[model samples]
Target: MTKRQSRWAKALALCLLASVASGCALPRSGPSKSEIYSGSVLEDGDAFVVSVNDRVTRATSVTPVLGFSSEFLNAGEVGSDTIRPGDTLGLTVWENVDDGLLSSAGQAATALEEVQVDGSGFIFVPYAGRIRAAGNTPERLRQIITEKLDAQTPDPQVIVTRLAGDGATVSVMGGIASQGVYPIERPTRRLSAMLAEAGGVTVTPEIAQITVMRGSHQSKVWFQDLFADPRLDIALRGGDRILVEEDTRSFSVLGATGSQNRIRFETQTLSAIEAIAQVGGLNSNLADPTGVFVFRNEPESIARAVLGRNDLVGDQRMVYVLDLTEPNGMFEARDFAIRDDDTLYVTQAPFVRWQKTLSAVTGSLTPFANYSQLAGN
Candidate 1:
């Protein structure tokens, strides 16, 4: 062969190999499993290559665990009948005799409306003087007013009604169906009921998060968990603030999956099988079942459990490997839980690179073959 043709063939092979082996520059979705391990901090490269097994699945099945604390759940229940300062009271005082102390010249009864309780927890009635109304119930206040008016008028009767007030209320904010202050009534004495009273959340229930802030204390729970586990509903308190927002937890999919995108968790607990299904599963033509990987920076405590060693400190970079071709491979994947911020990746089959090389070699050979024919002529 002439030197010109020889040089052209050699130059073509070198260019093809360089482009095919381009780590991040290639058109491939991402690096293969072996390429990912080379990025480990350890020299041996095993620090990032943990195999998924029963022990690993159970240890790394860490999901977002959210709920109200004991203090929030164990709070004393407040009865809706109880009155408080800032609450408006409506009273109707009836007397047997005409021209009574509270009544007009001809009327036997007098109606006192919009009588709001003072900040000091006291309310004033014409004949009853000042009475403490904050801690007393409406029924109890009726008895007190009746006794006071009885001394001035014969057979005096009283009826008390509590109006919608700022006394015992909750301020709901964020993506709720309605954002405003809702009164804590008999129908909305609990967290779930109060949320329902606000017309439910604006976000999907699967991704909804309910946060309750009472004074300096605050607690949160997933909207789905609140209904699944009744204990998370918790009791509502006066002057409490509630917020219904979408969950912030998410995971990303890369490599040879059906789709590559950052996906928000739609379920309370997401398994590997389910996460894979969320992205439309693996690409049948390019995926390598044996190279499924999950990359995450796990807390030191979890890293210890996964590696069965305590030497690692702080958060450890972990890459768990899953082999779906094994006998119980699918079962292990089903049990493994995908956590927030974790990256699920599937490498292309090993032979896929060779196919590219073959294509490049055959495609380039045509140009070289034509040059050889020209040289012969």
Candidate 2:
């Protein structure tokens, strides 16, 4: 070959080698490990965050409402206060009339295990056969027993007492120790006590996702409020079933984005622009300015009941395509909202993957070649 042609060929070879060895030529700074999808940017004026008292605006209309209610109370509304027929009572009643001494004679009178109250709320004893004990205080029962025994034994000593019934208990299932029934004493008013009884959530109970089911209705309480606010740690009731469920709702970002992987969106509303920022913004080179896609279920499903049918726009039900190439598009990207469980993927240029593979191969070859050359020397 001519000297000039040979020189050109050498230069080209060196450039090619450099491109493969360093990832600089791949367009994007680093090889992306994700696949991008298509989505849209919302109009700039449409996205905004509404404060609790902020006046409703076109932008604020899309924001979600945040508030507290009994259903949202962490401790949940006080369970039914009145005792029911099937309700189990963890009782501890004591009676020692006449200031009785602790002698062997009174030892037999001390009722121990399995001294259960029948369905009619009465327990029969040696002298006070079939005495009504349930619902009455230990003192009242003792007075009644004393009056009854007086007729037989001439001021006969009498005692009335009740202890926690082993059978009557509330079960704390899911995300807690002692996942079975816990004998309830007194009326349960605070939720934390029950949790403590059950060993306090298996692992924090995602406090925000906790649920309490009394009969049909279920209440949601955030753990933060339970401790931070006194109202959240409300008392519990008998037969109340508490469940510290996992927070199943979340979002994920993929492709040529700043942050990749899962991002939790616990609040009511999440927008596409917010999701992008959560993933650290798009990698400039790998991101296609013209073809950004937000993959989400039809907005009809997202805001169906949230916005109602009359409020939905024609584009609400369609997947939005956002062109982030222009400044206006940036504003629109900001407005395009994302929802829970939505996935945002920013795909690299199709050719980027091939370059990544080549770079890896070349990186491996250089190490092996250097090892061989040193050994040969």
lDDT of each: 0.86, 0.54
> C-alpha displacement of 148 in model 2, angstroms?
2.9
Q: Across residues 250-359, which tens digit of lDDT does each residue of candidate 1 receive?
A: 89999889999999998888888899999999999899999999989999999999888879889988888899999999999999999999999999997886676667
State how far residue 236 of model 1 sits from its true place (Å): 1.6
Mark the 10 consecutive residues where model 1 has the least summed lDDT: 19-28
Report residue 135 deviation for candidate 1 (angstroms): 0.9
Model 1 misplaced stretches (Cα beyond 4 Å)? 1-26, 41-47, 150-155, 365-377
Candidate 2 per-residue lDDT over residues 91-144, each given as its tens digit: 222334434222244342333334666677776555556777666665676677
